[model samples]
Target: MSKTVFITGTSSGIGRETALYFSENRWNVIATMRHPESRKTGLEGRKNIDVIHLDVLDPDSIQQAVTHALTTYGSIDAVVNNAGYAAFGPFEASTPEAVRRQFHTNVEGLMDVTRALIPVFRRQGHGTIVNVTSMAGRMTFPLYSLYNSTKWAVEGFSEAVAFELRPFNIKVKIIEPGIINTSFYDRSKDVLSTKEITAYDTLVEKIIRYEEGNIKKGKFSPPSVVARTIYKAATDGSWKLRYHTGKYSGTILGLRRVLPERTFIGMMRYLTLR
Candidate 1:
């Protein structure tokens, strides 16, 4: 009786790796993406994997994917909400529409998918929900204010829901990873600053350039690292409410918790300038 897990955003990166890893470990995987017809390179002919169409933005699509997974596997033991995008720029430079898009995909979309799946889990009497938040949710960084805000909302939402769902034996967990070697930084949406704010153009450009360079240098951990952490959280019985999955995430988060506010801000500023 292998458990079934439904994962969103399987088009690439962490979602794809998690699907592959769980399938390899003898679990049924419902791998979903927004554009199922896209000519993607991963998840080709995996025996235990079923690729499905799921657009988190659309309630109908979410329902269809959940129904399909239940029919294919007979039951779903976990749902991983991994489908989201990143928007990088100064908060003042970001447009209202850009902020809405971030909340739509990261916050509202996640809630929609979870709400769609809750009834199914309730019927089954036991299940898990794993949210893929970032270290940015806990700490602020330059040019990522809105993106961080969305993740922070996710962190809060997941925490509050965990308490409510405990009576039903439904577990909620948050996976917080530091910068990973994903296309997130490269493919993030950009909201151009108004020309009126011309004074900060050079500073903003330098920050953006540095971020791009860091991503290209491949200093972040592989997607498999996150995939493994997610797999453990999904299957293991001793599930904690939160997991810090990358090398630096725990250390930095711990520092933020214990260090003085001014000291933490100073360290962050030094890192940003570096």
Candidate 2:
């Protein structure tokens, strides 16, 4: 029997790419997204792939998606928790709803999905969980307070859970992608702003200009690179905890470990916000 993988946020970007990669590799893919109907063009009628509706914020949707996957594939070998969004800009500028939504979707949502799948994996005697965290989880940059916080939460959660799940024959993996060319750069990211407060306008403008300048010249990895890393994590059969993808992910993470805290902060500021 072919192994099966369930992936979230498969409407586009890394999620979509992962689905395609696994399908091409002959693994049955339960490709799910909030609006699967909109993605029918390239995905529908494809072999070994089933597009389903799954919104991480919706518990019922999560359960239904998992149930459908099990029913269709008989067993789910792994799950890729790639459903998340980013909120950028000053923390003070963010609305209460936006802040809640950020954690709810990124942190709480990931937990909910994992919680739902744990029982199935436990019953099966083995499974793999690949979380799509970010380089921001271990490091930080200006203008991404909420997004960084969420990814940091995921990093800690995945690391801690790996120890607990190992005895159950289940592995938890974290994929930290640095900067990838995806809709996350635009459509999938929420940029927060406070209309009434202009105090931080200059700082925000400077940061945006600096970041944009780099992006124009940035050598971003394609989403396919991340998909390959995820595939490796799923099939490697090792309890290895973290996998870094994208351009300079390994270099940046290495520097974070060797450099003093203040020195790393200074370097990041000079390179990004200066």
Candidate 3:
């Protein structure tokens, strides 16, 4: 029997590609998203894929999605937690509501889904959980403090869970991708400052201009690259805890490990500004 995988945020980007990649390879895919009736409707036509509704913020939706997957496939061999968004701006500019929303979707929502899956995996004696994090989790970037915080939380959560789940044969993996070509950048929410801090306006404007240029240039790796890496982590029995995808993800992470903090920060400042 072919193995089954449940992936969240399948409406676009990495999640969509991962679902398609696995389905093409003969794995049963439970592709889920917040709004299931949109352009992703055609995904249901795949030979072994089921597109379902899943709003990570809604516990009921999460439970329903899990139930449907379990009933259809009998077992969920892997789960790709890919439902998240980036909230970009200066930390001082971010409102409490914006910060809450970021954590709600990126951190709390992920844990909620993991909680719902733990018992099922335990019973089956094996499973894999892949959390889609980012290189920002390893190193900070200007104007992305809130987004980085959430990914930082994901990194810590995945690391801790890996140790806790090892005895149960439940493997946990973190896929840290560098700036991927995705709607994540284009569709990201920007929190505007309620009160202007004139001191940082120039810096903020420069960062915003840089972000817009990156989106227009579309220089990041294709989502398929991330999808392939996620597939390997889900299927390979190597037990690696983290997989870095995209051009600079691995190199940046490696530099953080070796370079002094001040030097690393200086290099990042120059790269982002220059």
lDDT of 1 by residue, 90-173 (tens): 677778898888899999999999998888889999999999998888898887788889999999999999998888899999
Query: What is the C-alpha lDDT profile of model 3 across 125-152, one tens digit per residue?
Result: 9999999999988899898888899999
Best by the lDDT measure: 2
Candidate that would win on TM-score: 2
- TM-score-best of 1 and 2: 2
Q: What local lDDT does model 1 show for residue 140?
A: 87
Candidate 2 C-alpha lDDT tens digits along 1-274: 8999999998889999999999999999999888876666377679889988999999999999988888877899999999998898888889899999999999999999999999999999999999999999999878899999999999999999988999999999999998898889789889886577888888888977875775898778899999999999999988789999999899999999999999999999888755
Any runs in candidate 3 off by more than 4 Å, and if so which?
190-199, 215-218
Ranking by TM-score: 2, 3, 1
- After aligning candidate 1 to the native by TM-score, how far in Å is the CA of 44 from where it should be? 3.5
Candidate number with the higher TM-score (1 or 3): 3
Residue 258 displacement (Å), model 1: 1.0
Candidate 1 ranges with C-alpha deviation above 4 Å: 191-196
Tell me which of candidates 1 and 2 scores higher on lDDT: 2
Worst 10 residues of 1 by lDDT: 185-194
Model 3 alpha-carbon miss at residue 259, Å: 0.8
